[model samples]
Target chain A: MVKEKEHEQDAEAGSYPTGQKPKYGPFDIRRYSPTQESKEKRKSNVLFFVALFAIIMLAVYGWYWYNTPGGERQVVQLKNALAPYNPATWYMGKLSQAQDIGNVWSAGGGNETLKGVLFDSFKVAGSEEIPQGSPVVFAYGLKLANAVVSKLPLTLSCNIKDKDIAGDIIPSNPLIISGKRITQNARCRFNSEITKELSGTVEVEGGVIFPFSTTDAKLKVYFTSEEMEQSLLSADEGDFFSYLGIDEQLPLRTAYNGEPIELGIGVSTENEQPVVLREGYNPLIGITLNNRWDGKMLNLTEFRLIIPKELSINQEISQNPNGLCPFTLARQGKTTNEYRASEELIEQVSLEKGRLRSFECWLDVAPELLGSAQYTVKEYEAEADYVYQLPSRTATITVKGVAGKETGIGEDLLSPLV
Target chain B: MGIKPIAIACICLVSLFFISGCDMLPNSIPGFGGNDESSVGGVLSASIFAPSNNGKVLSDYPFKPIVKIKNAGQFEAEGQTCITGLDKDVFSVFTGCECKSFKFEKEGATSEFEPISLEFGSYTVKPQEGDANQQFSAITRYEYVTDVTADLCISNDIYEDCGADPDAGGAIDAKISRVSGGPISIEGVQETVSYTGGSDTVTLIFTINARKSATGRLIPESDLNAQCTPVSADETPKVQAAVREFPITTPIRCRDAEVSADSTATIICEAKDISLINAKGQAVFEKGYTVPITFSLRYFFETVASSKFVVS
Candidate 1:
């Protein structure tokens, strides 16, 4: 009766009845239930873990944002700090006063001839070698296009800083005649003459060599550009003297030994040509200042271009057999190295007897129009005492080589090696 | 046992400190003024009596030496008149020509120039940090750039050569024989012509650098305390002036130079090359005159300052 009573009590407590397997399962699948305190404790434990994870994640991301390395953007790469980007100014050089040189006039359709001046012809900066049969040209004031000739007897010359490289300065009895076509008249649209002119072709047949660059390297290096263009639409030396404020058509004047009276920027119709400050006299362009590195633009701080009177090509003509000795030059556009000329003009120019000289060239003529105005040219004389001043230039590159045994702190610097 | 809760408590404490300590905004340093930039260690000043690039500072190494030209009379300003000596076009001004004439009125509005650009530079002093009373700060130096340029134009005015500082250029013309008796002179009326008596503008640049000071070093410009000395903080540089004739004997004509034809027929005017230093303290001008132009009446000349030079 006790066993029966105990069994009945267990069954009433909701457990599977000890002898009730005949109809259903003997045990309940559900596990034991927790007390109220235990349930609350479990909830708190889960909350603590979530909070801890969030704190750690925030720290890691914050650290990465401040200390991560990349380009200039990241904190570790922010070495070029922005203390203050206050840029100061620098004084480059000063300019001289402006002087009136000459004027320009709209001439006619006949071939044109420029006869102003070849103030000075100087070779500045490092020089290069002209190989045998190689096309060569000299760029000088006013007639820079005609300055360099081809098909000439080759002459060897070299240039370097302070005479490191030397070549024959000028060979005795040396004359080179490269058969470059010579034509006149084809000035710009405003200065063109009415007719085409002819330039005869010949070879001066002598060897003259310019062995060195400017003798005095201290001859203030002007910011000059010999960076020639494969594209040559205009033969304006003004591009070379871009550092100089003078333009291609701007007249050059003289300051030293110039007519006592200094002329200014003016023009007049004296010889049918509208000239800048023309007064029946040879005008000059003088350097207005001496000191360089002033804080002004287009500063003539270092040098100036002075036109020479003796070098005037437009002098009165006296009829002669060698009318315009370099006939190619008289016929304006007839003489051009722009295109590969006829083989006669583009003939091979090679060195002989260890010197390159004499070559063939064309001299243009204006027989049809300038019969009465036929002119003769004086001997081609370069200014013996003149020297050209090129502008100074520099390029800074961060050189990186082997640091060797003496590695220093700077990116490209190194300490003394043992 | 208490690791999680302890971590949470630590995080809360850290957040409170961060929120309370950081400002994340602009803050001014104590007792500093005029573009003062402060760090945890020191401060940098932008306008600490900024000196000009010209060598016009009163001393070689001024402690906050800044030059300010005030109350200068306005003169006639012509674009072409500024670089007339090169005789070349405005394009010739920069190409490789030297300074013909460099003058600027050091007083008032005439002295002000266009804002120039600055290039990269650096300044430093040995042991830059120290006490003001015990150790004086070492010399500070700055190497900044003041290079600027503008396009030059050709002045085609017919009257450009007639007593005209047209783009600072002139053509040789017949000289003025005599001064017309008038009530005006061309010096101030046409172009301020003052000849420097055997004077040449020799450029001398002075650069002073004020490194990041450890202690707040009192700048002479703004510091006027009991400890301040009688010396002015804004010391004036030694500006030299003189008169002389230029070699440019270009013939110039003064046709109708006088503004009024009826004022004074016997005006006594002297043709001189007036010159002064620009704010940068470089001799800017040395004007040459053909002859003095007399006017029947007084006419003020406008000063030309913006002479665009050709950049080579």
Candidate 2:
């Protein structure tokens, strides 16, 4: 009755109230519909079209509303005004604080990425200086503690914090060298290990080297530097043009290790430094001690000294008064001892302790004979390569015995030329 | 006149107007509530005529795209080992470099990942020839990609007590990083724009021939433990998605898309038997429409359609 009324009213008024009418006013709705009613109705088609059309229009208007960077930018800024400031750029802001010395490092990159560098090349560009002391060394060594041996000053500084290293240790802390004196003082401690054995000739310095105890420690030493290299480099081993590395010369890193040791520009000393060469019995010419046993309790019988050829003294200048200087090599222990070679131009060559090897004696000439024989060539322990192509020049080296056995001229002790 | 005739005339006129005026007009749609001045070639963008394309296309309720610039530059190590200058191989690596951005645009704009070829030019460098110290390669290849990026700075130069101690009492000596270069500034875009009805896939690539140069210590000393390793060029590449609704698909046509001022549309879009393949390129999403994830949509229109709205 409601539908009939709706229809009758719809026919007259051209509209229908919500009713059970299948279709009305030329409308037909049915096609792939999701309902059995719509499939069967075959009406309300115009209803579907109208609904779809309305939906599309709503979409069109939405497109014109939001979604543009310009609008977004302003909106984002306004949002930020109400939010907290973000802290992300702080890290990138801290890269300019290097030690910035005029040290603008300059180098070219290679394909492999590692390049050769010269960090301290400019320090000693033009100067030179040598040390002081007797150059020949046959019996003993010097024992100076904590000393600086550098040509240029070095500084260290760090920021290494405790958190930097893995364990709680700080790593940023830099070690800064405040001044030259300070730098030297910090670097005086030298630590190295070297051992040698000598047999041919033995001479021991007395009283000076460790209270002349036979069982006391034997300390060895040496001084080296680029300056030393320049003086003691084998004159025949290199050419002027090839000094830095050619046929005979090796790389600078290699040359540094092989250079000989030297000392003596000239320094005044009345008591003399405690670095004696040899003083007791001329242990070189095969001597036998009878009174007391000495030397590290290990008995000093079968020994061998292996010095490189470059360290041997040549006979060419052995005759010159510039030969070598007077230094003692002794071994004073708890009893009487054996004798080597010494000087009355000086004192007795005491041997109350241990023994030394390959001894040589020299003297200071008069100012008148300065050019002829007034030099002191250091005598080092003789090695197999120390043979003078010429012959052993003669010199009068004195010696003192216990029994008062009258010594021969220069033969047994200073053995002058034949 | 009869009252029924009078009522019928009013209803017919209203329905007719509603049907005629609710058509999409991508090119001439006026602004809605927001201040969007976007247009393409002086033409207003098409309005979204279909109810299906309303909210965010991204699955996430809130979507964010992260961007980052990594290893901004580097110094190659081929030529530095000798007395003579660097070798040519070092320059080659820098010359034939690949600068890429991995991003995915709106699906119909872009979806799924694929390879993009790019060719950039080479560079030649000399010792102290220019303030630049090294020559950079020219971009020869370009590819657009999408990925999520993280903003974490792992500093390599900080020393515990020696480097920069923000919480320290003494002077802080540190090496900080400076973001000298990266993406350029973009002027805000203001032109009518429209994207097609659904998400689209897009892929654009181009080459940038930028040279990277840096100098400092690298291979650590022999006495020092654990040397620094070379940064890999191929590890952990970035992937991101970009979105752009081109005005082409969303045309500027002559359609009146004004929804009835009083009525809102309820749109329901289903998978409708999707024919898409998974990343493995296998057919997927073909099952029947899943229910109750009932994504409810609500929208309003401004027009006299079906007597739902009155004429102004």
Displacement of the residue A32 alpha carbon in candidate 2, Å = 99
- TM-score of chain A, predicted model 1, versus the true chain A, to 2 decimals: 0.18
Worst 10 residues of 1 chain A by lDDT: A194-203
TM-score of chain B of 2: 0.13
Clash counts for all predictions? 187, 145
User: What are the per-residue Cα lDDT tens digits for candidate 2 across A345-418?
Assistant: 11322222222222232222222211111011111121111100110111111122212233222123322211
- Tell me, by TM-score, which candidate is best: 1
Off by over 4 Å in 2: A1-309, A314-418, B1-312
lDDT by residue (tens digit), candidate 1, A362-414:
22222221111101111111111111222211111111122342211231332
- Model 1 chain B is weakest, by summed lDDT over 10 consecutive residues, at B132-141
Report per-candidate DockQ.
0.00, 0.00
